[model samples]
Target chain A: MVQPGSIVGGLLGFLGKLGASVYFLGEILRQSGIGIARPRLVVEQIHNAGVLSLVIIMTSGLFVGMVLGLQGVDALSRLRQEDILGASVALVLLKELGPVVTALLFAGRAGTALASEIGLMRATDQLSAMEVMAIDPVRRIVAPRFLGGAISLPLLTGVFNVVGILGAWFIGVYVLGVDNGAFWSQMQEYVDPEDIWEGIFKSAAFGVAASLIAVFEGYNAVPTAEGVGLATTRTVVTTSIVILMLDYVITAALL
Target chain B: MDNLIEIKNLHFKRADRPIFAGLDLDIPRGKVTAIMGPSGTGKTTLLRMITGQLRAGQGSVRIADGDGMTDIGTLDRDAIYRLRRRMGMLFQNSALLTDLDVFENVAFPLREITDLPDRLIRPIVLMKLEAVGLRGAAGLMPSELSGGMGRRVAMARALVMDPELLLYDEPFSGLDPISLGVILRLIRETNDVLGLTSIVVSHDVEEIARLADYCYVIAEGRAIAHGPPAELARSESDLVRQFMAGAADGPVPFHYPAGDFARDLAGD
Candidate 1:
């Protein structure tokens, strides 16, 4: 039967897990510093996490931008401010949707993959083997993946922002009869560099959070098939919640 | 007795379940010491404690380098990692890195621990692979290799560091008779040629008896018998005799405890 005591105990256990995650993050950062010694390793991780993620980011950004253009034209036309479609698209994509969506997709894509890979490594005893060989598996294995994800997400967000802007331009100017002069002039005036930078910064934070969670969950998984599966699930769910929460907190803190 | 590693009154547990209580054992220098016992007797746990992978609950798990002895149970993480560099361990599953090929897997420790160039690393990797008779399989990924080949590759990786001590956890399991003979021979040959201390944790009594110079048999958290393999073969302890003889029925119970089957089925 459920009891108040059991509820309190469960909450305390979750808090303990949170504390452990913080410690694990600290260890990852420490190992990442050692990864600097082997710059090639970090580079390799970046290629996998950042470079491979570009395609989806670009595609999604373009489509989202186009949708924003269509919606802005419809919504603002009633207010007779249809010309501001470019400005609306630019502002929302740069300040909010682009980074958040990219990070969410990345969490689903790269984060789960990272967790599963590391979890499998633990189950197979490869991590133990590395420890026995006196090679810090954290430094050699995790640091690279962590650094890679951190570096990957922001760049992916950047590509998303650019491609998204181009898509908005196509729809707002050529496809529709919106005035190109108004579209260009209004966006140029209203969209500040700082707005774009906010998205970039938020996405970078998301990347670190996502990557760290993925690696930690994998590395500390229970060394079983079910444990690996659970870690992968947790990586996606936890990373999405973290990215969304960080987006809000960062926006509040910075803006 | 020139012991390379020693454990004194060691205590370790799995949560509330005690695996070792005041356990003491020694690994002699430049010789093969075997710890043989029934399944779940903590033979592998003893190896992990020596390697500093698992912490002992209490007491000393010490290893001697040329400079001095380091108590594994008390040493900090960095110190333990530094100490581990001077040793090698062969895990039961071979534990070859799935991402890397046989050559890269074997060369991994050397690359991480030393700043040796690829030119130098290549030759050393090849030599170690040749030692294990897996030189031709260097390019094969771990998944592509057979079980015995994986074991050989892992063995090559273990010796690549030229460690002061080599700890083998069930090196003989999951191998055919021929492969088992080959591995047993390789272990003895490698230890003698490299002049390294070795410990093999396994229940394969016949192979261990043929390979191990000194043997210790543990049961239910303590050593039941220990001596030279010849003396251990002639042990007076009933526990030792039953273990060494591989008897089906002994002091060790065959069935796990449960309620009476007839009463349970009737749901009384």
Candidate 2:
């Protein structure tokens, strides 16, 4: 007895939920004023959600840069233009990998944690308890996390790009024996500041999308053990998908 | 006696089922009123409506918060928060924040709702904990404490604001006999000492009959009966008779409604 009407209704329900989530994000931004009231909570969340993601971002970034250098040297050496190894690696990371990959990692690491924390709070009645105690859970609990993510993503991407460049430099100059002058000049000449700024904007936008999705899932999660688990999983999956889709759209528009 | 809370023609539903319909109830000022019912009988919903956590479909829930009776059914978010300061509710399972130690758990309301310094906040938290006979357990984290200790700390937290109306939602649900007795005594003593109106929602007949000054028995979203505790126990209503006597057979069915069990199992 599955009606076509029911299918349409389900779609409407989903759209309604999307609208509500966007409204919730607006509230988060409005209440905290970008964490102006409670800088301490913002800093704590940055330490938890943003700063903690650093080690992995840097490690992955370095390895990816090295792999790109090795592969670029292999291919370009065959063409006898291997002197531009640094240019290839830097262009690849700056234009695409730096923001996109860091965002995906951020989604998995910080996003799931934020959702589960809020979901558990709901299950334990802490949010209702806060409400009854005259405290706004949004202002007290959610706003800071949003601010942390927004501030941290650009900084994290910067670290990733820096470490990645260094790793590529090692492979290009010392390991592969590409001319040092050629590699440096090629990287500086090809990779513009605009390219780096594009990556920053993209990662910062991804931070907003990911953190908002995480908190929204947690705040509205069904109050149970299974519910919290599902919410956490949804935070990672949904944020990752949104990041990838946004990456494509941003690349299309910017480039 | 003045009525502290007044409900008029409450209508509420959940999960496509009616829970409360055209119901009216009242809470007397400075006296304990017990809302007794079987599980899933909307007692908690009533508490939620009173707190403005749950809205009514077609009625008003009014609470006397000093200046006048504010219609909680229609108060906005900020207004509700201000009104909440005059009320305290002790939830089942304590709901103590796990991140904070016992002292901070109790002191949380004061810390968040006011700008009091740590020096002044510390003694008030300790004093409230002393009231609940848990002053020594202040340093213990929520997980480190026993169930009774946790419940006591929650009670301390609920009372730290010196609220006018206190609500307890099955406060003794998981307690052992000793803990239950301690909680019962604490509720009675604290209600009297603080001169606060209190509501206790429970189906534990014997203990509630001892603890409550007045009682209301509800079933299927209707008030089956209500009176002084002793009088309520002697009610002639069929549900009351069965409930008070703890009889196995009653209007409240022992089994859920469904098709023939054997036939369904055999897929006949």
Candidate 3:
């Protein structure tokens, strides 16, 4: 009933895609039940989606933390509160930058890989061949990749959080000559367990969201070269937007 | 039950164009059948319908399983998967999993569907690879394979499940003459030795004549001719004759439909 080239038509098309994506997520979760039983499949995918992405995540995390250290010192030194650099950097990273930035990096790094791999499989008739063999591709091919991404993102975020803190500590305590004990002590004191828990929860949510979008875009990608390219592009853009939006909603709700 | 698959009044359309309109055909058990047609004539589409990858828009595509004839359109997703286990298809592109090496590719269905241990799987995989004359290439990845070797490996994989029915989509499209002969022999030998019914969709008129027991030439969504390969070659219908002879001008014109050449040349 929706008319083409009209405002309502565009809205309906978007809603239709959103609805299909949600349904695709449900299918992935359902197939994950089967995928989990075969741990090797999921584990192999974890290596592909998670292990392969470590270099970028860690590298970006270190740089982001160093930047935060320099910026935090510059801004707080004006108020003569530079001694509290440890507390502020730790708070910002653990509460916000850690999960959000890691997810953004993960999308660019791992998400695109998942999309392109699955998209190419479709383009090459590999998925259809699986179907012909009575193998459910959602179970065999997609769910493992989705679960791998979901599991790996939080773990990767954890790595980012640790490496980021180390980078900040190196900059603030060693280079800036802040009292080392004060840096460690204040970070431990002011950074509550809730802050760590919030970061963990946000990261886990982002991981699931980002992974779902990636595999969803891939499994449903049109079977062509241009189609696969576009699907890969959509995965990065959609995952980034969704992660940022979820960050706001999750932080607001948790706060 | 003599016929393994029966399609009646099979109507399918892609957007506004009809792909199969009231197409009826029967594939006999324990024989090689060829669905031959020129490009874009829905020969592959018909194969998809029979395999339940696609459904008939109106009419029925029925496959005779143990219970009885089951209409593909009536089956749900799980039902279709269950049905597909008894069917094997060799895709036009070979469709080998790029991640797996040649050995693993042939062993893929067994590993996915059966719990056979490596000890048993090893010999079985090697045997299928041996059948395809590629046992030496088992460890090589798909990227390393030539077009012919890839097709052979795929054929081995298609036969791995010991399926009752096998479908091949354009199996001889791109191959050297020697490779083509190897595949041609493999199709005939496997069909007979395994007691498997095969439906090969291809346009290789000479090749189909040498291999197929029966042939169906489809056009404009219907079977325009059906009989033995020799009988089809002798058909009087202009369309069938054009296809059989590979004629450039006949019912199917050499020149695409256009305005008057003289008028167009003068920029009318």
Candidate 4:
């Protein structure tokens, strides 16, 4: 029932609104006095957004590491490059795969949730209520989530990196009969501090992009059930696209 | 009394569609002014414009006087926030935060705006809740509340800041007679107790007639009638007469489809 042109127009409109909101947020933070600078909101958001995504990330990490290990062993065994297995796994986890995959999962799960919650609030006028009471919804609501996702993504990516490496090591050393010490030493030789930094930087950017897209979609949601659904769909699609695009750009620049 | 809120030559548009143009009105301090209008007549837009939620294209909305007065049009977003701190609004559908229980909902603005300790916030939230006769409902989520109860919780939350200006958008809608009486009494009592300036937007003529010290009839994006309710009740205008009498016929058509009416007439 909806046209593709309108959908594209809506997306552009959302981006424009988000740009305006970012400007608005900067103004709000500039003018807010010391009294309302409660760090508890951000702390709460970090806990909510970060800690809540842990189980999913951990589960996905373990399986992804196992699958990558299986595929790496299969391909490397054929090429007689099993000696470089650990370095390959570590490089993939730290450079291109771990942060990107985790971000995609987060965009699907937490990003969708954030959009729906915010969209519902917008639809119901809770944001307007906050404005009327002199409370900045951005400060109280969006900033917390934005900063939370920004902080949490890197932390979660680190968790994913660590867990994924361990899972891959377990698969390589035990399941595939690869030497544990040799595998670890290869990883130590090839993995650099820059690799970790690159992954973390990517995660942080992805987090911000995803959370911002979600919040923007939610804030601009039309006041209807159908609007909420559309906002949720847009949030997921936009966040996923942005995450993938940013991953490519960041990787291209950093590598 | 000096005007609490003054709008001068207000103009607004959305996506190039004209919402209002050259609108002017004055709301006296410490009085309840009811704005009545048909749907799409810019009643809610006027409220939003005055509250700084929507900026006017070419007019000024000034609230209070001297130190308290703030120009709604000129203030930046942050300044508008500070201005909003001195005001409260009860939305048509209550708009209570679903994630929060009644107590937390009432305490939200305080928690966000002030560094008040939990001990202090507790009593303030309870006091506001008590004022709304929802003291017992403080632990309930918004999902558990009836329409009237949710409105009261929203009122409680709105009053937690003890705002100087109170705005109500369709406060009487979806309320039972008893609940309506209670809400009306509470609005009047709270305004008097706080010495608050109140602005109500409502289509309920009887309620507006009973409650408003001054009533403004907005039709077709302009103020068609403005005065005391008694004065407007005596007006000879067809719009006012039809609106006040709740008639289906007058200057306003129901806007039902012609084909549907034609089919009904054929059946008859």
> Which candidate ranks first by DockQ, i.e. highest?
1
Model 4: docking quality category: medium
Could you report the DockQ of all the candidates, in the order they appear? 0.89, 0.75, 0.85, 0.76
Off by over 4 Å in 2: A1-10
Clashing pairs in 4: none
Candidate 1 residue B43 Cα shift, in angstroms, is 1.6
Error of 1 at B266 (Å): 2.3
Q: Candidate 4 residues A1-255, lDDT tens each?
A: 899999999999878876886775574345434224666777787787789999999988888888878888889999987767899998899888888898888888888888888889988999888888877777677777777777788888889988888888788889998888888888889888988888878888887777777777787789789999999999888778878888889888876
lDDT of 2 by residue, A10-57 (tens): 999979978999999889877886477557889999999878999999
Q: Rate the local accuracy (lDDT) of all candidates.
A: 0.88, 0.87, 0.91, 0.85
lDDT of 2 at A39: 79
- lDDT accuracy of residue B4 in candidate 2: 95
Show the lowest summed lDDT stretch of 10 residues, model 2 chain A.
A29-38
TM-score, cand. 2 = 0.96
The top-ranked prediction according to lDDT is: 3
TM-scores for all predictions? 0.96, 0.96, 0.96, 0.90
Per residue, candidate 2 scores C-alpha lDDT tens digits across B1-268 of 5899988878888987999877778899989999998889899889988887889888888988676887898899878888888888888878888889998899888987888999999999999998989898899999998788788898899999989888898988878899999999999999999999999999899999899998888887777788998997778888998888788778987878889999999999
Candidate 3 interface RMSD (Å): 0.6
Q: Name the TM-score of candidate 3.
A: 0.96
Better of 2 and 4 by TM-score: 2
